[model samples]
Target chain A: MQYRISFPHMGKYYIPIKKAMEAFVGNYGEVILPPPITKRTIELGALHSPDFVCVPFKYTLGNFIEALENGANVLFQIAGDCRLGFYSEVQEQILQDLDFDFTFHMMELNGKNAKGLYEVFKAMNPELTLPKVVSTLAVVVRIVYAMDGIEKYIRQNIGFEVEKGGFERIEKQFLAEIATAETMPQAGRIFKKYLKKLKTVALNKPAKPLRVGVVGELYVLMEPFSNYFIEKELAKFGIEVERFITASYLIFSTQHNVKKILKQADGYVSYEIGADGTDSVAKSVVMAKKGYDGIIHLKPFGCTPEVNSIPMVNKISEDFEIPVLYFSFDAQTSETGVKTRLEAFYDMLEMKKRGRAL
Target chain B: MKAYLGVDIGSISTKGVIIDGDNRIIANEYLWTEGNPIAAVKGVVESLQKQIAPEVQVMAVGTTGSARKLIGVVLNAQIVKNEITTHAIGTMSRVPDVRTILEIGGQDSKIILLRNGIVTDYAMNTICAAGTGSFLMSQAKRLGLAIEELGEMALQSENPTRIAARCTVFAESDLVHKAQIGHKKEDIVAGICTAVVNNYLNNVGKGKRILAPIVFQGGVSKNVGVVRAFEQILGHEIYVDEFGHLMGCLGAAVLAKNSGVEQLFDFNIQEVDFVTKGRECELCSNNCEIIYIYRNNEVLDAWGNRCERGLSA
Candidate 1:
């Protein structure tokens, strides 16, 4: 029985996910990747989901439905620290109630380290040996770190590429090559080759391109469509982007940096926020110190941690002398509304860079 | 003699302005969008064309507001900008000392902070239309009063009743309940005014500094009741320009003048035919819905594909 497993999409994180699955299954199984989130995806998810739940829930539920339709029997729900823990229980119940035959596995329910993830892998594959799991997990971790590093470079240079779509073309090539790897060593080689190729791309970035830092809720920050392709829009204006939220950040944030965050977020927040609130607070100061022209805080509407972080983020913006634009997105947000605000933001950043005279 | 044309097309209202080389408004027109932006834009264009002097040909065109993109494409505009930038430019051109701009249109409200003729920060009401002009207008109709008279009644109140303005539905029902409780019309109107000011402060104005030397504009700025409510709540004198409702178009005209892009904009384009077609591509699971704009049987532009597979790029 070849078990077909699937995971929801979040930007380029799918690259590392495919590599990990290739390592563990090694041609013994197939992976079912969900289609991109479209209007139909949201409708299906929203129709079955309880209203007022966070936007990511609806998106992941949609992903699950689409994956099931594509002949996947196993579904993985990667929940975060906050209200995300209960998502699988509710989603599984809904999917089962709809009479779908599938095995649901919820991982990282309590933010455990590698051992917890290993347990999940072992449960998924009872024939899996401890040594095999350890080797596969180690390779996957390294792949994630490498992928994140490459993306950082991509984000910095993609905005100023001399040839339009040059960086994106190379990025698509990297994903394709990485997905075909059959072993941990092969994956590492593929990533290294891409890094070398990425460095060769020509970029005509200005001596000092206006810099913008994006900090927000975990899902909203990672997913492009969720926030209306904000990073791409900024790139259109020749602005370099800095983003700290990613799958790697979530994994590393497991041990805790709340104390450092509390110190940085002093006078604004007195305690630790469950999700990316503290991280959002800390990154603002970092962006300010790095002299970014502006910052944008994006989160799905009704997200608690992001809502709580807004006033403090505004305070930070004032103290650091950097402007911050906040966008609370929901299903109801129109594309034109988002586009106009972004253009306005770009206008402000350009004015600030040019020393502010109407 | 060169003239610049600027159009501000929104979901609720459409406004157009034509200005000469001196940035003097030669002609302007304001009309309701009425759920059809293309028709309303055509109406504004025809009106402005008729009003402007024949020798002063339109040299450039600019567009701003929610429907700016569609109208810009249709008019072959030289400049297309968002309302925020246009509003700031327009306010600064008129009120040179303006530090803040509080604008509430038919369904949306925005607060912009400017320092030294540059926008420092800004915020818009997210996912809520409470306290906007349309909200107040509907509430006025429910009270059997003309929307114009509602403001006058609000000013006559000696003691105002309280009504919730966080949500339009809640505010409307709350107004009815207040009226049922035997509250006077003036008091209820005043209460609605205060509630709008408070709602603007808490929602759109959240975490924003409401400084002095603020210019209040947009359709809602015409309401003396809301203006007075804002003055009381903000503890500062709010300045309202005579052309407050036309600022978006005014700014767009200024931007066109500054853009220095020499595009001959002919009003004769009204004789042309334009159509938009939308279709879903079923090649892949992405199922991207592509939109194509055509002019006289020629494909003008196409967009809205997720990947290169579906896109002609």
Candidate 2:
């Protein structure tokens, strides 16, 4: 039986994730990339989700349901801290109740070790060698770093593109090209080619542009659909957006730099609150010290980690004398409400810049 | 004489104002929106047109409130701003020292914090409409009292009963239970008023520094009971403007005056047939809902699309 593997979507990281899953399935099967999230996805997600569960649960469940309906028989879920660790079990049971036939695999790490990940892949393909796994993962890591590098540049410049849709058009092409790479050098070459191509895109950015930083819950921060494409919305106001958290940054840098990040927060946060909550406080301090015009915090409704960090974030805002806009996204959040707040924020920032704030 | 035109079309009411270069109100009119902002704005514009002097020409137009975008297009507005900014500007213009502005409208409520003539921060109620004008109106109807009479009755109550107003459903059931349990009508009415005020302060006004010179505006400000409740709870005098309901339009007019952009504002929009239509673009999986405004079969503007495909569609 050939494996038709699928996973949930999280922003543009789908490219690297799909490549990684393909490497794992290799010749034995094919990876099924879930369709891009839409309004319908949210509706379907909310329909099956338990009332008041963080929205990411519903979104991922909806993604699994869609994947199952699309002939995928295998689903992969990565275990996470907070409420996310229990997602796989509950989602599996929900799917079973819905009478879908599929196998669910939940990958959990063992205290700063990736042996759990290796075991999961080895179980799926008993003949999988350690050398093969290491080489394949090396390429996947490069793809993630490459995608993140391109995205950071795009975030800061997408709002000021001389030709509308130019950045998105190239970014799409870049993702498609890099997804086919099988070696580290090949991945590096693809990243270089796209970076050069992206640099050539004409920009109408001002010498001193309004800058904003976004720090929040992981799922909402990474998934544009989940957060209503807030970064893109900020760009429309011609504000340079700087987001420090990416899949690559979270996996590689955050683990090693926790101490440094906490110190940068300047006693605002003494220790980790919960998953990614402390990082949010630290990043806000960094953004504030860098003189960012504003900061937007995005999270699913009743997100405990983010909710715990709000007081510190507020204190940072007070100390730095910078404005912070907090948005709690839910299944039924209205687009008009988001737009209204954003437009008002831009107006406030503009006025503040001109020394005539209102 | 040169003047500016501002129209604020909210969920429940429509307001229009004509202001001179000195920020003095030349002519103003207020009317019910009646679920048709276009018609309500036309009535307001027509009424203001009749009140203004014959020599006074409308130099520019501005629009605020929920339907600002729609009406801004219809009236050829030079400045279209959100209700928050407009409310701050309008309040500051009237009382330069206002530190806090508490506004409760038909379906929404917001608190604006200002410092030294600048709006420092603001927050609007999120995903809830429990403690707004509409909720009070519905409860008033259920109690077999006129909307205006409910407030008067509340002012007579010696003690206001506590009502659960975290959610509208709970508040409605709690009100009925109180009425059935031999609670005085005035006490219940006063309790409802307190509930609205408490809900607003707890939710919309949460975690913000609310200083003195607090100017309360919006339709709900017309209710003496709510005004008194605000003053009692905040332990500060709450100033209600005589033209509180007109603050939104007043701000819009002021903004248009200062925008430095002018166009001959024609009252002829009252005679123009403007139609708005919403259609879903199915070019991709996104299925974006696009709204188009039409005048004489020509599309004036289209929005709510996420991609270039909607433009082509």
Candidate 3:
């Protein structure tokens, strides 16, 4: 039996993890989900590591430790920018020092070439044929495409749904169905059906609630784990949530769409926040004028780009007369405090709306 | 007879300044980001709208900051530039003899080394909070002293004690230890100042040749204690311009004036319909989840990219 192992990303950008796992599982056997992330995990990593390492490094290291404890011998990591590429080695050394027995495959280390892909596949399944690897990759690609399409549709329309929990319930069902789906056609059908249902729910003949746009760092905004499930919590308040950040947009549509977005901004904001602050600022203005009630800004602690953009964002808020609630997330942030503030913010908006109507 | 506006957006603050043909400050606003760039810009614009003379229509606008591209798009700014260029231009325009610039803001710190008014080497500590304004603010809060008072109190110290000038955790414990040993509050405050200055020098200003005629700006420039600390460390009387906080905005405005461009624009950014979505970028292993901004139904801008792959700016 082959055990499938994948690390946890801060959010839905888990596609790469999923893709890597699929390739490994096809060659090996069943894939095991990595252990859940927690404060203890982070502590474990921090205790064993240097103090200057970034938070992601520590969290990932903790994740690997937990996965190994759960009998995950095969570890998968994708090499990329920043310290992440180097983290694999450091973490490997740490794990080895702790006397854990495991095999690690670093994808993208030799560059994303055919040879690297073949080597990874071969490492996972020494007896597997090349045809099997190709077929498995094709299936993984299809899954990724379907998942992206479904999520994109959901993001655009989630704010407009007339029935509360309809979109979320469907999304939950869709994720589960796709995870275990046997064929690409089956997953496609499930996606189509859910998309139709979501559209119908969103377009129901009724007045929509006040839409509040959320924008900020991708990790904090999209990953419920990182930001304490802020989006889900916001939805529970009956406020329509509009968010314009997603992985698909960055990877596929950024080159074609950023220019159009810039023109739309029309010189209201001076720059993008960090990497995405510009997008958040432009979207906040659009939502304000589009009759949205407020804007919520989020960012990871120590994010320089967002920090630089705050002044401009405040300017947008003042010019539009829109109230914006800002939150900075770190590992030590208190979830209870965040919830309390969010609830109060919603109440304040509600009171303002009532006063205006009266 | 046309005037231009320049907005400098930084991680810690947003600044806007207006200038006439002769490069005089017509209007300006400085505000804390509080983690909201859109709101911050809106505040700057509203303040500018009120401050601008009724007869002087804003002919052109330029934006520069970490968020310059987004703010530029939102404000219809004609030119957007990096903080280094914007800050240098703004400082050189004010203090032409400025050979070194030391700027410490809320979240980050920068050291600009200049030769003959040209930036030779510069380093920024975007990742550390050890030496920034926020660190000092928090330390002040811990000491139960107002941030404004800490600087003045430090000036009063006859014998400044030494505190750990490394990380926040170490510094905090060190401060407590010194206080427990009956160190005077004034001396402790001075120690804190020295620690912050030392931390900045070690982390951001390391291995860089800091020249004379230094200009210290950014949010931290307001602290007289930090100014004194720098003077003691660098052995030079640092120049803090009357409008030091507004230098970035001034620089952006200067650029706008130099470009000789005119575009009729409204400061009312509230009327525009914008939306944003956040997703993870899975193109490579980086998995950089990006935020996409949209105006109406069209994509307006994108940010939160670790690499330049997803953004044009």
Candidate 4:
């Protein structure tokens, strides 16, 4: 049996590519990485998709189309929050509409939907044993956890380093070394060494360098695709960046943290900001009092909660004498404009600090 | 002597509201967004600066809207919030007992359910523009009637026609069909109003229990026809505040006041020149277009990126 496996885009290709190649080679044949996402892929997806569908929907459809064209008989996609959960059926319809010969397996499509998943696996790997599939999934989970751990540590400390590019260089080395590691222990060793080296890179600056806490809508913050890399750019200016949003954090600790965040705002107001507004406002206030240099809030073009929380944030900024910058991202927004204002804000803060000393 | 500044930037319009500590509206201006939030915000800020009394200093600045962040950043706002929270706060302050909020703006509509003065559940339709202010504007244009006259014109009908109220395509076709059949102008206007309300009810308010006292807001709240249609469909009286379009801005002002901490903010943003650039991410199939902002050859901020690929770069 010649099995075909595919992975999407850069960075994710590292582990999945290795794993797929190993697993398929061990069983039957070879693995092929899906063609890079291009304008053509998006066009194809748009052509086949329902008009005015969300951009993600069109892109995912295009990915599947490209994968099928590359002779991939089996497709894998991780299921999660938002519209991604329902995208599989929609994508399947579009694929079937085009009459592609392929089998689809969406992991986490309700754990109880085991029979359907098993049938898909059986078709892809007729000699597949339940134990083997479980073990493969376990390995993949471990790799994901390890990658996430490395990413989390790097994100928090990368901005604090005294020397520019030190963290990134080590991060690159760590990724390269980890990719070559055959076992979890080797990946762990690589992570530990790089983390130590990262800590040693002195990040000493003025005791206070306009610490800006970025808090707002999740998509505009985490996805980088959505917010246009605001956090990284802020970090480049040596601003101590604090953003408490991530897919992992949202899934694991959001419910628990939300209560704590709300409780922190006890005396100010009891109203919620709809969706994540409450959380953003709470976090922004906390950061304001924490003596952070400034606060930068980001949200999507049409998001509601962030819109509601602006007043509260302004009040906090007024009360604390701290500056807060807000940014809304959309397709037409100019990055040049955002950066110019940010630099001016940074300069103004620096001037204020100098004037106070005088 | 305490004063607050509120900036509400929506898809279609950007509004600025200045209020005294006693919650009295001092100065307010509403202008079309013209598809550029940055320019609209700049216009709002410039207009607001001129409106402020020389004797009364701006104690706090708050921003709310779809473009709150960008505007907040540009204006150096003290507080920034989402539209729902801003609207809820604004409405609760004025009408204290609002249980439901039906906000239909230029490009979107939202049905917010409030229980015991707190937002319990809410649904928003941003993808579709059929039952929003734009829909009304389109119909008004087709009928050669100004949007402001739609409500009273609709109310004038003794016998209202029933038009399709699904997607824009079906609604437009039904309207043409009704006109071809020589339906009275008033009846057609009433039918269009009912159609828009029906579309909103089926899409945004679907699967949600709407209870009163319901508050209708956003730019479309000014349309009495929509308000009447909502009341007829939900079988409850709907209230539209005099300053309905300014609710988000009002909420932002209220929040600004409640924020106990006082900071001296300088509104000198106009003195600085800001520039921005755009790029596309090639790392993922998502191909998210990103923009990078620069000030004096230094990267000030970046946005529009989808994932981590372009973030660090």
lDDT of 2 by residue, B119-151 (tens): 777889887899999999999999999999987
For model 1, report the TM-score of its A chain: 0.91
Docking class of 2: medium
Residue ranges of candidate 1 with Cα displaced over 4 Å:
A22-29, A109-114, A180-189, A253-256, A263-267, B284-289, B307-313
lDDT of 3 by residue, A1-358 (tens): 5655656455544544465456555646555555555556667767777676555666677778877887877777656444556878988898899999877767662212445566666766787566665555555555566667776666545645666668778777777766665566766787787777667775432264656788876656766666777766676666666776655454344332556666555576654433565677667767777877788888766555666656666677667767677777665665545764565466546545654100
The top-ranked prediction according to lDDT is 2
What CAPRI grade goes to candidate 1? medium
TM-score for each candidate, following the candidate numbering? 0.95, 0.95, 0.51, 0.60
DockQ for every model, please: 0.66, 0.54, 0.02, 0.04
What pairs collide in candidate 2? none
lDDT of each: 0.83, 0.88, 0.72, 0.70
Positional deviation of residue B256's Cα in model 2 after best superposition, in angstroms:
1.9
Q: Model 1, range A129-192, lDDT digits (tens) per residue?
A: 6677667666666667667777888888788888898878888887777666656688778888
Error of 4 at A64 (Å): 5.5
Clashing pairs counted in every model: 0, 0, 83, 60
For residues A242-265, could you state the per-residue lDDT of candidate 2 as single tens digits? Answer: 998888887765453768878877
